[model samples]
Target: MTLLALAGCSSPDGGSQASPTITTTAAQATTAASKPGSRIFGLSDNQTAALDYLTTLEDRHAPFVSDDRLLALHRGGEICVDLDNGMSFSDLVASWKPELREDGAKLYVRAAVEKLCQDNRSKVPA
Candidate 1:
Protein backbone atom coordinates (compact mmCIF):
# COMPACT_ATOMS: atom_id res chain seq x y z
CA MET A 1 0.00 0.00 0.00
CA THR A 2 1.92 2.96 1.36
CA LEU A 3 5.05 1.05 0.52
CA LEU A 4 4.30 1.35 -3.19
CA ALA A 5 4.35 5.09 -2.76
CA LEU A 6 8.00 4.88 -1.91
CA ALA A 7 10.37 4.73 -4.84
CA GLY A 8 12.53 1.69 -5.50
CA CYS A 9 15.23 0.66 -3.04
CA SER A 10 13.47 2.62 -0.30
CA SER A 11 12.26 1.38 3.03
CA PRO A 12 10.66 2.66 6.22
CA ASP A 13 14.16 3.27 7.52
CA GLY A 14 15.00 5.31 4.44
CA GLY A 15 13.11 7.99 2.52
CA SER A 16 11.80 7.50 -1.02
CA GLN A 17 12.54 9.25 -4.31
CA ALA A 18 10.03 10.74 -6.78
CA SER A 19 9.15 9.28 -10.20
CA PRO A 20 6.55 9.61 -12.94
CA THR A 21 3.67 7.22 -13.73
CA ILE A 22 0.24 7.24 -15.41
CA THR A 23 -1.93 6.30 -18.40
CA THR A 24 -0.81 6.01 -22.01
CA THR A 25 -1.97 4.38 -25.18
CA ALA A 26 -0.35 1.12 -26.20
CA ALA A 27 1.07 2.97 -29.18
CA GLN A 28 2.73 5.48 -26.90
CA ALA A 29 4.16 2.68 -24.85
CA THR A 30 5.54 1.05 -27.99
CA THR A 31 6.92 4.31 -29.32
CA ALA A 32 8.61 5.03 -26.04
CA ALA A 33 10.02 1.54 -25.89
CA SER A 34 11.37 1.84 -29.42
CA LYS A 35 13.65 4.75 -28.60
CA PRO A 36 17.29 3.77 -27.99
CA GLY A 37 18.42 4.06 -24.40
CA SER A 38 14.74 4.26 -23.45
CA ARG A 39 15.12 1.13 -21.40
CA ILE A 40 17.74 0.10 -18.93
CA PHE A 41 19.76 -2.84 -20.22
CA GLY A 42 19.20 -6.36 -18.80
CA LEU A 43 15.43 -6.18 -19.01
CA SER A 44 13.48 -7.88 -21.78
CA ASP A 45 11.79 -5.68 -24.33
CA ASN A 46 8.40 -6.56 -22.82
CA GLN A 47 9.59 -5.65 -19.36
CA THR A 48 10.92 -2.39 -20.70
CA ALA A 49 7.58 -1.88 -22.39
CA ALA A 50 5.92 -2.33 -19.05
CA LEU A 51 8.10 0.34 -17.50
CA ASP A 52 7.34 2.66 -20.35
CA TYR A 53 3.69 1.83 -19.96
CA LEU A 54 3.75 2.83 -16.35
CA THR A 55 5.25 6.16 -17.30
CA THR A 56 2.17 7.00 -19.32
CA LEU A 57 -0.27 6.57 -16.44
CA GLU A 58 -1.95 9.52 -14.75
CA ASP A 59 0.63 10.92 -12.35
CA ARG A 60 -1.77 11.72 -9.54
CA HIS A 61 -2.98 8.14 -9.37
CA ALA A 62 0.26 6.42 -10.34
CA PRO A 63 3.10 8.81 -9.97
CA PHE A 64 6.24 6.95 -11.14
CA VAL A 65 7.89 8.90 -13.92
CA SER A 66 9.89 11.42 -11.94
CA ASP A 67 11.88 8.87 -9.97
CA ASP A 68 14.94 6.88 -10.87
CA ARG A 69 13.92 3.86 -12.97
CA LEU A 70 16.05 1.43 -10.97
CA LEU A 71 14.38 2.42 -7.77
CA ALA A 72 11.00 2.11 -9.41
CA LEU A 73 11.82 -1.49 -10.32
CA HIS A 74 12.77 -2.12 -6.72
CA ARG A 75 9.45 -0.81 -5.49
CA GLY A 76 7.55 -3.02 -7.93
CA GLY A 77 9.46 -6.04 -6.65
CA GLU A 78 8.57 -5.13 -3.10
CA ILE A 79 4.93 -4.79 -4.01
CA CYS A 80 5.02 -8.27 -5.50
CA VAL A 81 6.65 -9.62 -2.39
CA ASP A 82 3.86 -8.26 -0.28
CA LEU A 83 1.27 -9.58 -2.66
CA ASP A 84 2.87 -13.00 -2.59
CA ASN A 85 2.62 -12.90 1.18
CA GLY A 86 -1.15 -12.40 0.88
CA MET A 87 -1.33 -8.73 1.45
CA SER A 88 -4.96 -7.63 1.11
CA PHE A 89 -6.50 -4.71 -0.67
CA SER A 90 -7.93 -3.30 2.54
CA ASP A 91 -4.57 -3.43 4.20
CA LEU A 92 -2.91 -2.09 1.10
CA VAL A 93 -5.26 0.84 0.92
CA ALA A 94 -4.99 1.41 4.64
CA SER A 95 -1.26 1.88 4.26
CA TRP A 96 -1.73 4.77 1.90
CA LYS A 97 -1.47 8.38 2.87
CA PRO A 98 -4.84 10.08 2.52
CA GLU A 99 -3.69 12.18 -0.37
CA LEU A 100 -2.30 9.15 -2.14
CA ARG A 101 -5.65 7.44 -2.21
CA GLU A 102 -6.69 7.77 -5.80
CA ASP A 103 -9.14 5.60 -7.73
CA GLY A 104 -6.46 4.68 -10.25
CA ALA A 105 -4.00 3.65 -7.59
CA LYS A 106 -5.23 0.08 -7.62
CA LEU A 107 -4.86 -0.04 -11.38
CA TYR A 108 -1.37 1.33 -11.04
CA VAL A 109 -0.49 -1.35 -8.53
CA ARG A 110 -2.06 -4.00 -10.73
CA ALA A 111 0.01 -2.98 -13.73
CA ALA A 112 3.19 -3.27 -11.70
CA VAL A 113 2.08 -6.62 -10.40
CA GLU A 114 1.27 -7.89 -13.86
CA LYS A 115 4.34 -6.50 -15.60
CA LEU A 116 7.09 -6.20 -13.01
CA CYS A 117 5.93 -8.71 -10.43
CA GLN A 118 5.60 -11.68 -12.68
CA ASP A 119 5.19 -14.32 -9.99
CA ASN A 120 2.56 -12.29 -8.21
CA ARG A 121 0.81 -11.11 -11.32
CA SER A 122 -2.10 -13.34 -10.56
CA LYS A 123 -2.31 -11.92 -7.06
CA VAL A 124 -3.57 -8.54 -8.06
CA PRO A 125 -6.40 -7.34 -5.85
CA ALA A 126 -9.96 -7.94 -7.04
Candidate 2:
Protein backbone atom coordinates (compact mmCIF):
# COMPACT_ATOMS: atom_id res chain seq x y z
CA MET A 1 0.00 0.00 0.00
CA THR A 2 2.86 2.35 0.75
CA LEU A 3 4.38 1.50 -2.59
CA LEU A 4 1.06 2.15 -4.28
CA ALA A 5 0.69 5.39 -2.37
CA LEU A 6 4.17 6.50 -3.41
CA ALA A 7 3.82 5.32 -6.99
CA GLY A 8 0.61 7.26 -7.38
CA CYS A 9 2.13 10.57 -6.25
CA SER A 10 4.89 10.89 -8.85
CA SER A 11 4.70 13.45 -11.63
CA PRO A 12 5.23 12.68 -15.30
CA ASP A 13 7.07 15.96 -15.81
CA GLY A 14 10.81 16.30 -15.22
CA GLY A 15 10.36 19.02 -12.61
CA SER A 16 11.93 19.22 -9.19
CA GLN A 17 9.72 19.81 -6.19
CA ALA A 18 9.65 18.56 -2.65
CA SER A 19 8.66 14.96 -2.33
CA PRO A 20 5.60 14.43 -0.14
CA THR A 21 6.18 13.61 3.48
CA ILE A 22 4.66 10.36 4.65
CA THR A 23 2.85 10.80 7.90
CA THR A 24 2.42 7.81 10.09
CA THR A 25 -1.07 9.10 10.57
CA ALA A 26 -3.79 6.93 11.99
CA ALA A 27 -6.07 7.37 8.99
CA GLN A 28 -3.46 6.23 6.54
CA ALA A 29 -2.54 3.15 8.49
CA THR A 30 -6.17 2.70 9.48
CA THR A 31 -7.19 2.52 5.88
CA ALA A 32 -4.80 -0.33 5.46
CA ALA A 33 -6.03 -2.04 8.63
CA SER A 34 -9.63 -1.71 7.51
CA LYS A 35 -8.82 -3.54 4.35
CA PRO A 36 -8.17 -7.17 5.17
CA GLY A 37 -6.95 -7.86 1.67
CA SER A 38 -4.36 -5.11 1.51
CA ARG A 39 -0.67 -5.82 1.92
CA ILE A 40 0.16 -2.53 3.59
CA PHE A 41 -1.10 -2.75 7.16
CA GLY A 42 1.39 -3.52 9.92
CA LEU A 43 3.96 -4.34 7.31
CA SER A 44 5.91 -7.51 7.87
CA ASP A 45 9.34 -6.88 9.33
CA ASN A 46 10.84 -7.46 5.92
CA GLN A 47 8.49 -5.02 4.22
CA THR A 48 9.23 -2.36 6.82
CA ALA A 49 12.93 -2.88 6.27
CA ALA A 50 12.51 -2.55 2.53
CA LEU A 51 10.42 0.57 2.95
CA ASP A 52 13.04 2.07 5.27
CA TYR A 53 15.76 1.28 2.77
CA LEU A 54 13.86 2.95 -0.05
CA THR A 55 12.96 5.96 2.09
CA THR A 56 16.65 6.45 2.90
CA LEU A 57 17.51 6.31 -0.78
CA GLU A 58 14.79 8.80 -1.62
CA ASP A 59 16.00 11.16 1.05
CA ARG A 60 19.49 11.01 -0.40
CA HIS A 61 18.43 11.44 -4.03
CA ALA A 62 15.17 13.40 -4.08
CA PRO A 63 16.80 16.82 -4.33
CA PHE A 64 18.67 15.85 -7.47
CA VAL A 65 16.06 13.62 -9.11
CA SER A 66 13.18 14.26 -11.50
CA ASP A 67 9.76 12.82 -10.87
CA ASP A 68 9.72 11.22 -14.29
CA ARG A 69 13.01 9.44 -13.65
CA LEU A 70 11.68 8.21 -10.33
CA LEU A 71 8.50 7.01 -11.96
CA ALA A 72 10.51 5.17 -14.60
CA LEU A 73 12.59 3.49 -11.94
CA HIS A 74 9.42 2.45 -10.10
CA ARG A 75 7.93 1.07 -13.27
CA GLY A 76 11.10 -0.81 -14.06
CA GLY A 77 10.98 -2.35 -10.62
CA GLU A 78 7.34 -3.27 -11.06
CA ILE A 79 8.13 -4.96 -14.34
CA CYS A 80 10.92 -6.95 -12.81
CA VAL A 81 8.84 -8.08 -9.85
CA ASP A 82 5.85 -8.87 -11.99
CA LEU A 83 7.98 -11.06 -14.21
CA ASP A 84 9.55 -12.75 -11.21
CA ASN A 85 6.23 -13.47 -9.51
CA GLY A 86 4.10 -14.09 -12.60
CA MET A 87 1.69 -11.35 -11.57
CA SER A 88 0.25 -8.64 -13.79
CA PHE A 89 1.08 -5.13 -12.69
CA SER A 90 -2.53 -4.10 -13.14
CA ASP A 91 -3.80 -6.82 -10.89
CA LEU A 92 -1.19 -6.06 -8.30
CA VAL A 93 -2.16 -2.42 -8.33
CA ALA A 94 -5.85 -3.24 -8.35
CA SER A 95 -5.54 -4.94 -5.00
CA TRP A 96 -4.25 -1.75 -3.46
CA LYS A 97 -6.53 0.65 -5.31
CA PRO A 98 -9.10 0.71 -2.54
CA GLU A 99 -6.55 1.66 0.09
CA LEU A 100 -4.73 4.18 -2.11
CA ARG A 101 -7.85 6.11 -3.01
CA GLU A 102 -6.28 9.55 -2.66
CA ASP A 103 -4.03 10.64 -5.52
CA GLY A 104 -2.37 13.41 -3.52
CA ALA A 105 -1.21 11.04 -0.84
CA LYS A 106 0.06 8.76 -3.59
CA LEU A 107 2.19 11.55 -5.09
CA TYR A 108 4.03 11.78 -1.80
CA VAL A 109 4.87 8.10 -1.73
CA ARG A 110 5.94 7.44 -5.36
CA ALA A 111 9.55 8.54 -5.26
CA ALA A 112 10.30 6.29 -2.31
CA VAL A 113 8.74 3.30 -3.98
CA GLU A 114 10.60 3.98 -7.22
CA LYS A 115 13.96 4.03 -5.53
CA LEU A 116 13.11 0.83 -3.68
CA CYS A 117 12.12 -0.89 -6.86
CA GLN A 118 15.18 0.34 -8.71
CA ASP A 119 17.47 -1.00 -6.04
CA ASN A 120 15.67 -4.33 -5.94
CA ARG A 121 15.75 -4.89 -9.69
CA SER A 122 18.53 -7.41 -9.55
CA LYS A 123 16.42 -9.72 -7.41
CA VAL A 124 14.05 -10.22 -10.28
CA PRO A 125 14.19 -13.66 -11.79
CA ALA A 126 15.52 -14.13 -15.30
Candidate 3:
Protein backbone atom coordinates (compact mmCIF):
# COMPACT_ATOMS: atom_id res chain seq x y z
CA MET A 1 0.00 0.00 0.00
CA THR A 2 1.10 3.59 -0.43
CA LEU A 3 2.33 4.51 3.02
CA LEU A 4 2.96 8.01 1.78
CA ALA A 5 2.22 9.56 -1.57
CA LEU A 6 3.22 13.11 -0.94
CA ALA A 7 5.88 14.78 -3.04
CA GLY A 8 8.24 17.38 -1.62
CA CYS A 9 6.12 17.69 1.46
CA SER A 10 7.21 19.78 4.38
CA SER A 11 6.85 18.67 7.97
CA PRO A 12 3.91 19.97 10.00
CA ASP A 13 6.45 21.98 11.99
CA GLY A 14 7.01 23.96 8.78
CA GLY A 15 10.78 23.55 8.55
CA SER A 16 11.93 19.92 8.73
CA GLN A 17 11.63 18.00 5.50
CA ALA A 18 9.11 15.23 5.65
CA SER A 19 10.32 11.70 5.14
CA PRO A 20 9.75 10.34 1.69
CA THR A 21 6.73 8.16 1.19
CA ILE A 22 7.46 4.55 1.99
CA THR A 23 5.57 1.81 0.29
CA THR A 24 5.64 -1.83 1.35
CA THR A 25 4.26 -4.81 -0.46
CA ALA A 26 2.70 -7.79 1.23
CA ALA A 27 6.02 -9.58 0.95
CA GLN A 28 7.79 -6.84 2.87
CA ALA A 29 5.37 -6.75 5.79
CA THR A 30 6.52 -9.80 7.70
CA THR A 31 6.61 -9.50 11.47
CA ALA A 32 7.43 -11.92 14.26
CA ALA A 33 4.73 -12.69 16.78
CA SER A 34 5.67 -11.52 20.24
CA LYS A 35 2.68 -11.36 22.55
CA PRO A 36 1.09 -14.58 23.74
CA GLY A 37 -2.43 -15.54 24.67
CA SER A 38 -3.58 -13.30 27.47
CA ARG A 39 -6.56 -10.96 27.31
CA ILE A 40 -6.07 -7.63 29.00
CA PHE A 41 -8.76 -5.13 30.08
CA GLY A 42 -11.33 -7.04 28.05
CA LEU A 43 -9.28 -7.04 24.88
CA SER A 44 -8.49 -10.33 23.18
CA ASP A 45 -4.94 -11.59 23.20
CA ASN A 46 -4.50 -10.85 19.54
CA GLN A 47 -5.71 -7.30 19.93
CA THR A 48 -3.39 -6.70 22.83
CA ALA A 49 -0.48 -8.14 20.95
CA ALA A 50 -1.20 -6.08 17.85
CA LEU A 51 -1.34 -2.91 19.91
CA ASP A 52 1.93 -3.67 21.62
CA TYR A 53 3.68 -4.36 18.37
CA LEU A 54 2.32 -1.22 16.71
CA THR A 55 3.39 0.96 19.63
CA THR A 56 6.90 -0.39 19.41
CA LEU A 57 7.09 0.16 15.67
CA GLU A 58 5.64 3.67 16.03
CA ASP A 59 8.60 4.77 18.11
CA ARG A 60 10.80 4.06 15.13
CA HIS A 61 8.56 4.98 12.20
CA ALA A 62 6.23 7.92 11.94
CA PRO A 63 3.05 6.68 10.34
CA PHE A 64 1.55 8.28 7.24
CA VAL A 65 -1.96 6.87 7.40
CA SER A 66 -5.02 7.21 9.58
CA ASP A 67 -6.52 4.42 11.69
CA ASP A 68 -9.61 4.17 9.53
CA ARG A 69 -7.59 4.22 6.33
CA LEU A 70 -5.31 1.55 7.73
CA LEU A 71 -8.24 -0.72 8.45
CA ALA A 72 -9.56 -0.11 4.98
CA LEU A 73 -6.19 -1.08 3.59
CA HIS A 74 -6.25 -4.30 5.57
CA ARG A 75 -9.78 -5.11 4.51
CA GLY A 76 -8.96 -4.37 0.92
CA GLY A 77 -5.93 -6.70 1.02
CA GLU A 78 -3.43 -3.89 0.85
CA ILE A 79 -2.46 -5.37 4.19
CA CYS A 80 -2.34 -9.11 4.71
CA VAL A 81 -3.33 -11.36 7.61
CA ASP A 82 -2.46 -14.89 8.57
CA LEU A 83 -5.55 -17.00 9.08
CA ASP A 84 -3.43 -19.41 11.10
CA ASN A 85 -2.80 -16.79 13.74
CA GLY A 86 -6.16 -17.61 15.37
CA MET A 87 -7.02 -13.94 15.35
CA SER A 88 -9.76 -12.10 13.53
CA PHE A 89 -8.48 -9.15 11.51
CA SER A 90 -11.88 -7.51 11.86
CA ASP A 91 -11.71 -7.71 15.62
CA LEU A 92 -8.24 -6.31 15.66
CA VAL A 93 -9.28 -3.37 13.52
CA ALA A 94 -12.33 -2.77 15.66
CA SER A 95 -10.18 -2.72 18.77
CA TRP A 96 -8.36 0.28 17.42
CA LYS A 97 -11.48 2.40 17.08
CA PRO A 98 -11.54 3.52 20.67
CA GLU A 99 -8.05 4.88 20.52
CA LEU A 100 -8.49 6.87 17.33
CA ARG A 101 -8.36 10.10 19.30
CA GLU A 102 -5.10 9.35 21.10
CA ASP A 103 -2.91 11.95 19.47
CA GLY A 104 -0.64 10.52 16.74
CA ALA A 105 -0.32 7.11 18.26
CA LYS A 106 -3.22 5.77 16.25
CA LEU A 107 -1.50 6.61 12.96
CA TYR A 108 1.61 4.64 13.86
CA VAL A 109 -0.46 1.80 15.24
CA ARG A 110 -2.53 1.68 12.07
CA ALA A 111 0.53 1.63 9.83
CA ALA A 112 2.03 -1.18 11.89
CA VAL A 113 -1.19 -3.14 11.58
CA GLU A 114 -1.24 -2.65 7.82
CA LYS A 115 2.25 -4.10 7.45
CA LEU A 116 1.52 -6.90 9.86
CA CYS A 117 -1.70 -7.83 8.11
CA GLN A 118 -0.02 -7.75 4.73
CA ASP A 119 2.69 -10.01 6.03
CA ASN A 120 0.16 -12.42 7.44
CA ARG A 121 -1.88 -12.58 4.26
CA SER A 122 1.16 -13.16 2.13
CA LYS A 123 2.07 -16.21 4.16
CA VAL A 124 -1.27 -17.90 3.54
CA PRO A 125 -1.86 -20.42 0.80
CA ALA A 126 -2.81 -18.64 -2.38
Instruction: Estimate candidate 3's RMSD in Å.
Output: 12.7
CA error at residue 86 for candidate 2, angstroms: 2.1
Candidate whose TM-score is highest: 1
Per-residue error for 37 in candidate 3, Å, reads 12
Residue-pair clashes per candidate, as listed? 17, 5, 5
Query: Per-residue CA lDDT of candidate 3, range 2-97, in tens?
Result: 334222447677875756444434332222331112111111213333444444454545433464333433332222232334545455444545
Q: Quick one: best lDDT, which candidate? A: 1
Question: Which of the predicted structures, 2 or 3, would earn the higher lDDT when compared with the native?
Answer: 2
Candidate 1 vs candidate 3: which has greater TM-score? 1
How would the candidate models be sorted by TM-score, starting from the highest?
Answer: 1, 2, 3
Q: What lDDT is reached at residue 99 by model 2? A: 45
How much is the lDDT of residue 30 in candidate 1? 58
Instruction: Give candidate 2's root-mean-square deviation (CA, Å).
Output: 13.2
Model 2, position 119, has a per-residue lDDT of: 36
- Reference-based lDDT, residue 29, model 1: 53
What range of 10 consecutive residues in model 1 has the weakest lDDT sum?
36-45
| Candidate 1 lDDT over residue span 14-105, tens digit each | 87655444455677555433433333221233445444435534343465545444445545444555665688655655554353454545
Of the pair 2 and 3, which is ahead by TM-score? 2
Write down the lDDT that model 3 would get. 0.37
